[model samples]
Target chain A: MSETAKSSALRGAAKSARVHVMRSQLGRVRGLGAAHGGTHHWWAERLTGIALVPLSLWFIYAALHLSGEPRSYVVRWAGNPINAALLAALVLATFHHAQLGLQAVVDDYIHHKRTRLVVLLLIRGAAALLALIALFAVLKLAISG
Target chain B: MKDIRDALMVGRTSDGRLVHRPLSPHLQVYRPQITSVLSILHRATGIALSVGTLLLVWWLAAAATGDAAYAGVSAFMRSPIGVLLLLGWTASLWYHFCAGLRHLGWDAGFGLDLPQVHRSGRAVVIAAAVLTLLTWIVGLAVM
Candidate 1:
């Protein structure tokens, strides 16, 4: 209905007595079904975020140390086994957290169904692709020496 | 139209009548406050850092490629635009970090009250600023 009609028909709509909704539903259509994600998404976002707290702080400290260093210096730095492993962990956690956060934004803001789907896919796909690239790059650097 | 006939907010009543449903993004409806603003900023910075991941991968790709490629990427990093982008990313990262800790605190059932909430909001901003400046100073000033 047009907004005018909807507005005009509001005679006691707020308190308008019993509408026969299902026993466990807000409407006849029931929602998009059990979603299946549930608390998994919530828990993963937080877990990855928690992992990133240290990973990212370490990166910042390492980055400052390498700020003005040359190509060889960076190469040597990343080549270390410990640094390589931490770097890999950081890559995985960062992208995982990032895509989750991006997904939440798209879910909340993009009301259009198809557009939301496409945007969500794009962001997630980019996150995955970039993460793989970063991991492989770190691996290559580690082994290049 | 009563001003916004939001399609998603359009719902059908029991007697086949049409009515408006409620949803959010009504952020403008409320007065601006520090707590809400910081909450929003946390998400905003998160999105920013997500985009900044592109640069991180690019830098890594350059490093993996070879000496010339690494030098090229390093030159770009030392450039003005690159520095500006890095600075923006740095600020966002630290801010998001601080705000994220506050969120974790709330999740763990700490600092739920209004006074603590507002106080922590201010603390997040201050800590982020200090950390960012310290990082850049160390990045540029120290060995």
Candidate 2:
């Protein structure tokens, strides 16, 4: 190649390399990238974690109260509008947080990429199924009452 | 003094890609500490709680199904085996809950010091125990 052409190509290569490095650095600073993405996952996990505090306490208390109660009593307790609303909130938050936590755990320990993806999907599916079941039960009681 | 290449063994896989099996430190290489043990327990209890959710779904389903189904489930739940399972689930729930709070504390820039970490680790266990016991006592009393 001609001297000018060779020099121009070298400069272009250097500029491209610099741009690549700059993009990676920017990614690191912005907390978003191919590897880590943004902090949304972290923030969502914490938000749900915090929500679980009150919901979990309420659930334990309610569950304990319902223990050994007759079918009619359970139907009545669950049919209460306030109780149904709280139970719905609890199920949604619990399943959402559980899905996020399980995804993190599986991603951390399961090394095989394909296996990790499958497990994460399975976790989400199971959480959704359970959530649906809980919600349906609450709705049944609420409507039938 | 020794050859460095001996420490860096790279083998070609069947797909013709080079791979290195790193000799990284694992659980056996270090002494057990409160923080590390608690970390493992945190994961364990999380899994336990996930399984417990299934039981919750079953109870809710039975309740929604009808009187006979609810009666069957309620009977099992009050049985010896069922009570034991419930107790374990209760303990796991509280442990996970306490550990989760500790994690939030770390995220909020508190309890990051080594001593504080250890203290909080201990606190999580104690709180879980106390809470579990209190819940069961009150639960049984009201029953």
Instruction: Please state the error at residue B117 of candidate 1 in Å.
Output: 0.5
What's the lDDT for residue B71 in model 1?
Answer: 83
* Residue-wise C-alpha lDDT for candidate 1, range B1-143, written one tens digit per residue: 45564767888887899988877756678999998889899999998998899889998898888889888888888899999999999999999999999999999989999999999999999999999999988888954
Which candidate leads in lDDT? 1
Which fraction of the native contacts appears in each prediction? Answer: 0.76, 0.63
lDDT of 1 by residue, A35-78 (tens): 32436778998999899999999999988888878778888999
- List pairs with backbone clashes in candidate 1: none
Which runs of model 2 end up more than 4 angstroms from their true locations?
A: A1-38, B1-23
Per-candidate local distance difference test: 0.87, 0.86
Q: Tell me the DockQ of each model, to 2 decimals.
A: 0.56, 0.55
| DockQ, 0 to 1 scale, candidate 1 | 0.56
What C-alpha lDDT, on a 0 to 100 scale, does residue B91 get in candidate 1? Answer: 100
| Residue lDDT tens for model 2, B1-143 | 14466466667775899887555565799999898899999999988888888888888888888999998888888899989989999999999999999999998889899999988999999999999999999988878
Cα distance off (Å), candidate 2, residue A72: 0.7
